[model samples]
Structures are given as structure tokens and as C-alpha cells.
Target: MGEVDIFKIMKEAEKRKKIKEKPILVKKVEIKEILPCLTTPGYIRFTAQADREIADVIPIIFLMFPPGKTNYSVKENTLTLRAFNRMITFFPNGKIAVTNTRDKQEAEEILQKIIDIINEAYRSYLKYGKPSKETIEAAAKLSWMDIYNSLPKTNCGECGYQTCSAFAVSLLQGETKLSKCKPLKGEYFKNLERLKQKIGEIMLNTLGWE
Candidate 1:
């Protein structure tokens, strides 16, 4: 019998379901303000508003990624993170501020991505119960530790990183590709397989990738 390609199976199932998925989205978003962002010097900030409040989904959406290099405030219902080389801040009242973007079109595109993510989280919340405070906190504790442990650990610079630890950090941040680590092709090939499953080839393929 031929072996089952689990990743392919899962991807197909998700694609089939995605066709029927209908998510409630903010009706309209208008960019009402444009301000200079000191962070990127020449770059600017895009301030926009959604049609409805997104307070409930803010925390749920934040769970989409690890807490590394991100800031969140429960009281204020806000999240700040990096994506598309821009700094994005999500507010509970459906306000969005994207910084470090020089063009209006790019800002609008980024806003759409954020809306897609928000809708994704809303769907998850509908299917599964809201994530607990404990679950959110635990996910934050997931640092470069597990990812670092899964590396070749040879401190090789072949991956354009000074050390394997650096490469692991980049991997967690989705800054670099898994194929960049050369040693994994050698005796540490097992590490490659392990990393693939850990990182979830199927999950990443289906998720809203930044």
C-alpha cells in the first residue's frame, strides 16, 4: 500500500472547507488620517477605522502568533506587532494604525490582511470556546527555547546567521526559511523532519501567513 501523505490530505480538506467559509467583516474602512511616523523617518502612519468594534476578537486574534516581539494590553484591548516591514497596532474600537508604510495603497492592503486575520480568529472562537487567559499566557512563554533545541546546534554560519541560536530566533519570527540551515541536510536530517512537524507544514499552509 502506498503511504498516506498527511500534509496533502489536510491541505485538501482545508481548501474544501475554505470555499464554504463566510466570515463577518468590518463593512467599510476609511483612512481618515495620515501622519509622519518617527520610527521609519521617511515612512508614515495610516490611521483607519472599521465599521464595528473588534474588542472581543483582539485577544483571540493575538493568539495567532507567539508573543515574541509583540506587545499587548488587556485593559486597553490593543495589540502591536510587526508585519510586512510595518508596525501594526490593533485597537478594540476597530481602529487600526499601520506605521512605516510610505504608500496609501500598501497601507490599505495591510489593513485588509489584518481584517482577514480578525475574521479568522472570530471563526475559531465560534467553533471553539474562547481561549483562556492561561492559554494565552502559556503561548507567550513559548520562546526560542523549543525552536532552539530543535536546531542542528553546530553554530554554523551557512544559514547567514552567526550561530544556530540566531537561526532559531529567525525561524520563530518567520524571518528565514527552514531550508537555509545547511547542516540539517547532512547527519542532522532527522532534525529537519522534526522541525517540519513541529512547525506544522499543514497548519502554516492553511493559516494567514504574514
Candidate 2:
């Protein structure tokens, strides 16, 4: 049996306690308006307000959105994404709109979930420092065809896509892994290197971010 250090155990517990005690950036949100959701005929949209600005957290929350469903405008200081079966829009001043929910309670619950997302991103920022600035335009400029041409084009079905073109589409959507192509690790190794250069870090790291 290993000797346990009681002081070390107490220090670890204090560290976790301090983390839990950290104040949340978004304590609560108040629903300001409710309207029929234009995009989804049967759903409702609720606009809400937060206690503080959350613009800085957008980059960290990018992956929280469904693949291919996110758009961010640094110039406009806004982010829009479809996630959790809802369309959500965010602004720098803490204004938020969420569609596909009904009534105040439902709206608050959904916004609370958003707060959780924000808290998660905030924690990461505090722990790791700010994320590196990515070349969003580069990812935006990439076409599925560009990815398709760079692939082995074997249509091997090892990646679960029926055709190389389909896989390319999935890759562009950030829905599929480049390593899943299989042949890239073997016969098509050079093509893999070429793809890395063309696609840059987004594809190389399989983050699919822009």
C-alpha cells in the first residue's frame, strides 16, 4: 500500500472548491420578447438579456455548435449557430435570441444551458489563456471540391462514405475525420501531406473551424 499524503489531499480539495466558487459570467438572463420563429413554422423565438458582455467567448464556443451551422462576424460583433435543435444568435452586449422553444420557463432553461456553455468556455480561457487567432477566411474559402481533389479518391468506403466526393463534403462540413480515409496513412501518404498544405491547420488538426 502507498502512503497517502493528507496535506496534498486537502490542497487538492481546496483547489476544486475555489474553482466551484468562481463567479459565473452570466448569472441569469431575462426574456425580453417572444415571437413566432420564422425559420421553423411551429416554433417560437425568445430574445433575452444577460448581466455582462460575452463576445470574447464566441471563439471558444464555436465547437459547441452543430457542424456547418455556425457563422461569426467579428466586424458585427455577433455569432449565430444552430445547436440543440435551436437557432441561436449572440451579440457582444449580452443580448441573445433562441428559436424553437416556447414559454418563459423553457426559454430560461435553454438560456441556462447557454450559460453553462459560456461557463465552460470561460473556464477554458482562464486555464489556458486566450486561443490563438485562426485564419477564418482561409477556412471559409475552402471548397468541398478542393478537399475532394486532394483525397486519395479511392472510394474505398472505409470512411463510411459511398464515394470520395461524399467524404469530401463531410470533411468540409467538419463532420468527418481526414484520418478516416485510411489510404492516407499508406499508399496515398503524399496526397495526405498535400492536403495538409492546401487545407492548413483546420483540416490538419481536424478542427474544421473557420
- Per-residue CA lDDT of candidate 1, range 1-210, in tens? 999999999999999898557776565677879988878787789899988888887777666654454677765769987767777888888888888887788788877787777787777777655766655554445467776776788887898999888877776676775567767668887865664454443222222222
Clashes of each: 0, 0
Flag clash pairs in model 2.
none
lDDT, model 2, position 210:
24
lDDT of the candidates, in the order given: 0.70, 0.73
TM-score of 1: 0.62
lDDT (10s digit) by residue, model 2, range 1-210: 999999999999999999789857778877899999887786689899888898777655653442366776756757887777888888888899899885667787898888887887677657645545443434445677777877888788998999999998887666877778888788888876775555444336643322
Q: Which residue segments of model 1 deviate by more than 4 Å?
A: 1-21, 146-168, 175-210
RMSD score of candidate 2 (Å): 5.7
What's model 2's lDDT at 146? 72
* Model 2 regions lying over 4 Å from their true place: 1-24, 39-42, 63-67, 127-134, 185-210
The worst-scoring run of ten residues by lDDT in candidate 2 lies at 201-210
